[model samples]
Target: MHDTGHNDVSPELDRRLMAAGLRLGRRNLGQTHPNPAVGALVVRHDSDGPIVVGRGWTAPGGRPHAETMALEQAGDAARGATIYTTLEPCAHDGKTPPCTDALIAAGPERVVMAIDDPDPRVSGKGRAALEAAGIVVTDGVLAKEAARDHAGHFSLVQKGRPHVTLKLAVSADGMIGRREGERMMITSKPALTAVQAMRSTSDAVVIGIGTVLIDDPRLTVRLPGLAGLSPLRVVLDPSGRLPLDSRLVTTADKVPVMAVVGPAAPANAKAALIESGVQVVETSDGPNGLNLHEALAALGEAGMTRVLVEGGARVAASLLSEDLLDEIVLFRAPVVVGPDGVRALEGYALSAIERSPRYRQIDAAIVGDDLMRRYWRD
Candidate 1:
């Protein structure tokens, strides 16, 4: 727990507050994209100790921010109380009134924020506004953790592209599939469930035409109650190779599907996809295929803040080759596939080890017989 040198709040209390805020904020992950999930807690001090007067987390779909909800619940008790929030309260009026105004109106004696919102519209304005109102403000408490929690939202704000995560389930020998014509089941039941959880939270799930043709994956969240939360399904079919009667196209009415293709794709194929209710996005051509950067920019413009790339080798190589991937979630099963098996990545080469992209290992855990490893770009 990093501390900002502004408030007299005890170090222990600050740690507890930041921990509580982070817990609350995580409850809404995958539910809030474009807008960072935030958590707020209002506490008052007494002889015994500090007691929480109110608490709130950002709601699903990112409306009525945490500060607003907490202040509403605190009512008059908010006066002279200390506020602990995971992210800086917003000062802009995008979907709601400025949270700074709400905090000021509630008369909180001190405000503790974990990380500054990266959006230029409200980056430092919220803290400045609170300070101008004679309220004590402390920032950068558990700042790194808060930033990690909202990396997707921050990436969209800063880079104008959705935060891309490449997910792969490979064999112990690094093979994603069995020999050419063989059916492959590399992961255990628990790992498949974990993939469902990932899909439920993402703004979109992306794959290449080869995957669509071979696996014919529904790419929808299949967890009991989370089925309705399926994310948008995106296909990179540069040559319009996706079939018209595919499940993705047929189910477009229920869950949105986007077919991204290059300009040279057949016009008839584009019309067929559109008729099937799939949104067809045509982008410029790259040396290898459709321009991935342009495709990501289109997704960002359409309000997607996070994307899960479930690959068929070529697509994974393309994103990695272009340096567009931000994170990687690898599920390694205990089984070993031989050299004839399909590789997880293809066509990515580096002359020297030093020139290769590096990632920091964030976590590793066992799920059933499989090992799940998470990494972020260094």
Candidate 2:
């Protein structure tokens, strides 16, 4: 939607820079799920004009990362180019090499960074590395925008835990489902795409048995070409009640965990699921259903620091009950259904909600007629 046709570095250039920035940001999006949406830009001058040499961003499938891609594209021309990027470059080694090393090796004249990496792994090292190389570096260019794009990932990096998001699709009167147990699509295409985008931005997607039973949804990313790039699928079915034929069980190839309460799932349950090839893990249960704290801890131990909670009221209440939630993201549709139906949070008592997690407002916008607000948990 942004025009990058004009030259002369006018507002148009800024738009193009931003659009390019968005593209670069997108590069690291899927990889940083559980992290933040980060991108990079390289500006080099040639004999003809200010030749923008390379546009490097993070890639899908969570490999190589942004800085690596940027350096690969910049090769040789990086000597005097300015590297414009969203988020602070990483210093610690991860799935790829350190971003700071890549920048240093590229020999850029300057580095214009949008926001600092909140992950303890590279809180300040990337900048330190660049400055140490005697490169002119400007930190925090378009910092707010960078933070807005990667609020969920930033929350995890800063807090040392996943950004807990709570999404509920309700009726005009605020009921989640109908009295007769019928559930319909409450959000439009944009909203659904927004949900899919959230999947693309998170390390894992979580839901309870109720939702699994009702929808049997794939719970995977399905945004055009972005379908295969999705977070790990997680189900909270303490009773091991999820149907074996569910699409989530059949489709997800990643190590899917089913947080259950019993010592072991029933023989029939195991037989049904194993026949379809889905792994199940049983852990201690909470009074509600699943032990959310244990499940979250297990996820973190398994290197999943960020999680999204797509709820069926009871699950939302369970997470809220443990006080383990880091953030809350509620998508309230314009429609409303009256009382006598499922409330947004089903089991928790209003008076019992004592310690509400604190969050900082990041951005609020209308994405194709749907209101989308992002927040960072403190």
Q: Which candidate should be chosen as best, given TM-score against the real structure?
A: 1
Clash pairs, candidate 1, are none
Clashes of each: 0, 13
Give stretches of model 1 more than 4 Å off: 1-6, 348-357
Cα lDDT, all candidates: 0.86, 0.66
**Model 2 CA RMSD to the hidden true structure, in angstroms:** 5.7
Q: Look at candidate 1 and tell me the lDDT of residue 58.
A: 87
TM per candidate comes to 0.94, 0.79
Instruction: State which candidate has the highest lDDT.
Output: 1
Q: What is the clash count of model 2?
A: 13
lDDT of 2 at 260: 43
lDDT of 1 by residue, 261-360 (tens): 9977999999989988999998999945699999999999888888999987888888887889888898989998897888777754311111344777
Candidate 2 displacement at residue 252 in angstroms: 4.1
